[model samples]
Target chain A: MTSASPLSRLPPGPLLVLGYGNPGRLDDGLGPAFCEALRLRLGGDAHRAGPHRMTIRDAFQLNVEDAAEVADHDCVVFVDATLPGPGTFSFEPVTPSTRRAEFTTHSATPAGIMGLARDLLGADTQGYALGIRGGEFGGFGERLSPVARCHLALALDHFTALLPRQEGRPTVCATPIRGEGVHHD
Target chain B: MNPVLQTDTERIVIEPVTRVEGHGKVTIHRDAEGRVAQARLHIVEFRGFERFIQGRPYWEMPVAVQRLCGICPVSHHLCAAKAVDLLVGGESLTPTAEKIRRLMHYGQFFQSHALHFFHLASPDLLFGFDADPVDRNVLGVAAAHPELARQGILMRKWGQEIIQATAGKKVHGTGAIPGGVNRSLTREERDTLRAPVSHMLTWAREALELARGYTLENLPDVGHFGDFESNYLALVRADGAMDIYDGELRAIDPRGEILLQEPDSQRYLDVIAEEVRPWSYMKFPYLKPLGPEEGWYRVGPLARVNACDFIDTPEAEEARQEFKGLAGGGPVHHTMAYHWARMIELLHCAEVIQRLLDDDDLLGAELRTEGPRRRREGVGILEAPRGTLFHHYRVGDDDLVTRCNLIVSTTSNNEGMNRSVTQVAKQRMEGVDRITEGMMNEVEVAIRAYDPCLSCATHALGQMPLIVELVDEGGDVLDRRARSGGS
Candidate 1:
């Protein structure tokens, strides 16, 4: 199977991990830290040795560029810290639309930074959204919520699955809860 | 529920209301040494346009945002288009789109700058504050200097015509799209613009000479008064072109020191903070680097002049020469010379608009990208007639906007203008417990010089009375006056 036109031209790369969260808040740093952890696990040697430069892209304050970057890469993994709602990590593979307004940095959100990434990347970009529970927000600290720490391992397992694999031409994994019809698994 | 309430004073209590385009009053006890009393500016109507616009479709964002102000809607439209272009990457439109956009803005510049100068500020310049307040308006100016008044109206009207032709609508237009404009200009429309351009230039000279007739050495006392100073900021191209519509943000000190030049708009969140006053609907915007209490900076004409070293055109350069003379020397920091800076801008706006009308691409019909606008969440920032305006939004999957944030000039200049008011109130007020209506009106006039869009400044207003009162030391009320008429 194949995607036509613009979607067919998604960036050809080995591994792309996208971290989306507000750096100014406390636990939101979970997204960036997850990317850092993955970096430490894979090491720069792996990215440099590979064909593309998909090390880490942190959208501290997400803007339109978040979508553009994702569209330009292959095998993209999205990471973010979720707000403390159900006291659990919602690990879901999501597909999102390229519409700029669907994703946001604030409230009542369905589509997220990861969804934006998938929308831009098309089939060339394999995307996932991993969020840890957030307890204290608005303050300056990079620690996860108590409930999120428990599910950190689950997030890592999902994250690692995509990094080890090659750019599978047609990769579909999990149902996207927050994603628009732009991307589907 | 009242944002502005009275506090203790020596004898009377005063409640002041601040606004988007202008300032107000709250007076109390005087200095320990005894000069003027405590006065607070209550920004009565703050239209949290930034907050109100959340969740709107991206395409319509600019149109709605442009309505936020009557003075600089043109700039708002252009800025919105510029912002959307960043995401759309219609770089295919490049220099042509860029130049045409600039030309459209020139039309805005011509119209708005003229209105502020001739219709609003010119009355003050031609007639003294001491000149019977009843007859001291545009009508009075027409009755007095008929030719100048007529010419002023014509010049401003021509500006409106330019905008109408370019955007398909006059006051608030979304003609500028991501790829380019939604419409094109034909030769006939362009041809009609020629006479107005010549007519405005001739009238601009007459207006300048009229202003020059009242030199600083012998001018009305108020026009010659003022010494307060604050930092200035604006946008400038890397090559030094005037960046009023699409340039990097820059800030400079009164001494011409480059405090900040070509700063990133994205980083504006880091360096700038919006201050709120519950009394008035307007929000005060301050430089974040200076801290909440300390970062008070001025925007608009006086600030614009103080921000840039020179005007963009040769005619404006000559007008700048006259501006220096009006100040009796260096940068005129007085609230009064906001009039002078305004006139200079009017002259420049006309000249620039003329230059754009001479451009070839403005006639091109190809405007939009035929491509469905995919980007939904975007920010549109521009220098409006008052100051900086921001339109931010989030879209839903269906391309319908979900949320929005609109930060207009009224909000951006709120803090500093409020601070500036305290100075003027002190300068004009004599007794803390017996403030007069004229004194309050004087303060209000000081604000109208900016000609802020009250609708944009105050999201809501149902005949809010303009009240002036005198208060005592214990913040007790003494004498109070409220009127509906602005002038």
Candidate 2:
């Protein structure tokens, strides 16, 4: 509810943009798509350490081992695609779950991941989840649906807007990098 | 192992087994006298790769098969590519092509093994298997040993980086072609990988030490946990050195004596036969020569360690020596040893990757070569992270695939996994009226030793359902729980 920049209030440590989902599947790729867009807009310096430093990674899905990586970071953002939501995107703060985490298969829940980060590594890493509504997620293709693309644009705008902003230098989020204006149904 | 009980009793079903890579369950039957009746690890997911890939072109086999599972896509990609290579380039590959493929495979081993040990199995090893299920995961391991957990993640990340450097992407890259790779490694890519060589090796050594310590602590109880004697199968080089990327099929008896060592993977049909069960979608693969019941053999890390005479890599060989010493010159029948063998193989992967990085051919100009399709049918067999994987294909003259038969590593270990569960169940659950969650986890711990990738084995996509239940005599469910799991 606070208008403060999420990046500015974070503990002094590296920021991580963890994108996880099946890129091979259509709309499920929104996570990586968002990360790729962020990388392009932020330039190569995004990987380097600085006041605005951030690490970007993409995986098919979250695994148990990701907890340690998440714990190492001072701040973490989990990007994923959800089945078409009432809203185009939903950004929620993550808190460790008290319910015992289940190690089932390859995937771990975002809350489970955060819980592991906090409980296991004794990390105070603040976490947030950006769930972008996905239109299509079941096919074997990397392209996003039109509606999903629109949601991705909005999610990117909201994500970049939360980052520590600098004066004079223009932000890519201010303008459409894909040359396509965000669409509304 | 106890015989199946004929008396009426209760049944405890741990369905949709958790933590492993697929959909499965552990069922423990109790007899009238409150004794353990029978236990089985059932893989319920159906595999459709053989049917769906019928119309696809032979060239697309590598990429098409990689989509079967998100984990270990490189194994499928590289194995399928080799089979495709046989169709295009006879028995041998060009020097550069062979080295690059091997390099990629070593990377696959490094990543997959690191994942299994650090993320999957270490929770059980570091924290006791009976430890709170909530705290028995990578996160839990991290909480307990932060340094080791970080090392495991970094090691796996390095492995993925190697994959991305060689292939185009980390998950499912299209760098591999029929006769060779899509391109040679760039100087920058090579340097990036080279910088972490020593650090990776150091981390691997530390991991090996940790595994060795665990193995030593559990050695006394190892014989009681999934300790069933059976045949072992793996791919070994001509000299019987452990070879994961490419080699001849080798089968050894419980006594560690060679039973059958064949070079041609195409002749696999003559020796191996698949049996179907009404209860599970997974096929029970057995040695045809021995016939179904007596033919079942174990594969994966344990089998490979048992079947091979020695590991070629120095560090791995040393570790192998320490591992085999536990058995006093016989195959290690202890299911728990799978973790030890896996860690040893992990060392070998890092060593092999480091060795491959030193090869100049990896940076060669000639990335691919083509030849006429001399054969209509080709079989690619490699030691996948879990076990020996077989990819057989029959192509039409037009180059489209007519038939596809895949025997994944998990499928090969199907019978053994069931036996292991039964063994553990019989040992732990005997004379118990009720089954607790911790008791059920013991059965799962046995199956976890195999590290079965049920999705890959059954070719079932999406989330695998997991259910644990307690059924009273006459098969009425008393208690049940389910989890939708995907990884």
Candidate 3:
């Protein structure tokens, strides 16, 4: 991690993991799915789990109003599915975006929201964009695609390791994937 | 491409109107004489949630339908919950259940309105209408006026917090269900929200003040920008006070006289009907008695404030009085005044939310009661953040939805939006064959006033989100533009 990265200077508290996207759209539901898997792996607690306890939330999409919730937390992790290559995912640090020209109430990008948390709410909230590559975004269903399911397992293991480990749980191997800024699983 | 003759009339299109939700295109046609011939705003995408929802169980509607639009899911959630309530049994809700739903609706309005004014509209209001396109957005506003932008973000934060506290989560919350909600408010949650109530009120007042100041500064532009007289539609209480959650549907003429008042949502079919135009996927809804031409009406904050007699809240009432006087008691026709009215509603929502939180009845144990499914057809009507929303569902004897129809706020204002775009084109781009980027941006500003959710109104399936075309009188394309990436 770079020394200038905001993620390096987080305060003491449970990390906030926010997963947002349209769950009805097949693999677009990966973000919420990640939150669910993380909760179960951390002992099935929605708000707290394991040694590095974290609060988990899932929503259809991000909005400007979400910056407030981000402000009160020490560290945040935003998870979502992207239209990139299949079976590939990236986890990159989020920086305040200065090029966000237009703002809409209905939907907002994670970087744009992070900017709001930092610039508007004066929160030292730092975060990462854990983007899992999605294959299908059409049709309304609560199931994931084949390739998305493959990436989900490894992605969950990588995120599970980021938190404080609890005793009696076996940790998965962490190996780097395809993306340049991605974490290993 | 063949070069058009200099003497021929030109067509101009602004596709993918920026700074609004979803995909929409604006088209302007010029005649042989170089005069404006036609202008229309077209809805481009069709997800068809209405058609796909046919086989789902009625109980799953509140959760399923809210996914139609991520921007205003609360509106859909509460509206669907109300409609499903009718199918379950009676139209009445327990006091606690009703109050919790009301608080959630207020949160929707506050966050939606603040997002519009501060992020979408402020850049145009603070900078000139003809300002540089790059400097005419949220980033520019932040760079020049940091304090104002910060206030907007923080205020929206409070609104979301209220949603999480009462509704369980901000987006696609399962707190609200048929007949009543799933849970009640806790004292801790109530006290936490109470602290920001006063701060929100103060900030909303400042926003209103700034809107009034800007309106005065640009009197000429405000008067003619997309200005047109039209009918109004909104929900009003029995006492004629503005109510968003539950109320009777009321329609008033252009002169502010009552045209129709239907106490039940079921009676909506008797007074209102829809006409599908060939050019767009959105349906045009109009009053049945007046026929299609004269039936197109407006909704949203402007219509609600104009259709009502008084506001029940004190500060909102004062603001409403000032807003009413803007037109000397007549309907304010200036399109820009929508911002001013939106601010007033924002204050009203904040005030009402505070009051509902203080009411100890929200903690009652009787959160919801069971009712047998007796009705096959039910209609739910309420005021969404954009305007009035209608949800009608027909279920089979098995309690499964057979048919679903929706008339969103954007569809209700379809005629008005088309008229506004035509007026702007005629007033600003009549003789010019080539328009500047700034002029195109001004046309979008007019549509932004209504804050239409094109994603919700869209009923057809298409890949392109926005496509603008300039066509000659003979239908030859003179110029064209398309916008990619969802707006």
TM-score top scorer: 3
Q: List the lowest-lDDT window of 10 residues for candidate 1 chain B.
A: B11-20
> Which regions of candidate 2 deviate over 4 angstroms?
A1-17, A23-26, A35-57, A64-76, A92-105, A109-128, A135-147, A160-185, B1-7, B461-466, B474-487
| DockQ leader | 3
Tell how far residue B34 is off in model 2, in angstroms.
2.3
Task: Name the weakest run of 10 consecutive residues (lDDT summed) in model 3 chain A.
Answer: A176-185
lDDT of 1 by residue, B323-416 (tens): 7655454556666666666666767777777787788777775665534455545665566666666655566776566666566665555655
> What tens-digit string does per-residue lDDT give for candidate 2 at B1-487?
2134243777776766777876776667777676776777776666787898998899998888998888889999988998888888645777777887888888888988898888788888877878876677676666678788778877887888788877778888888888888877877788889898998999988888888888788778876888888999999999999999888999999999888988888898988999987767788999888889988999999999999999998999988988888889889888888988888998898888988898888889887887765788889999999999999999998889999999999988988988888878888788766667677778888888898898898765566456677667776777776655531
lDDT tens digits by residue: candidate 2, A1-185: 22223443434458899888776678888888888777766764544454646888887788665777787788899999889757788887887752444445466778887776676567788888888889986677767788888888787777777666446654344666561321212
| Descending-TM-score candidate ranking | 3, 2, 1
What lDDT score goes with residue A161 in model 3?
Answer: 53
lDDT at B440, model 3: 80
Candidate 1 Cα errors over 4 Å, as ranges = A1-185, B1-7, B10-35, B91-96, B212-215, B218-226, B277-280, B321-331, B369-377, B394-403, B432-434, B460-465, B471-482
Q: Going through the candidates in order, what is chain B's TM-score?
A: 0.86, 0.95, 0.94
Q: All candidates' lDDT scores?
A: 0.57, 0.80, 0.79
Interface RMSD of each: 21.0, 4.0, 3.2
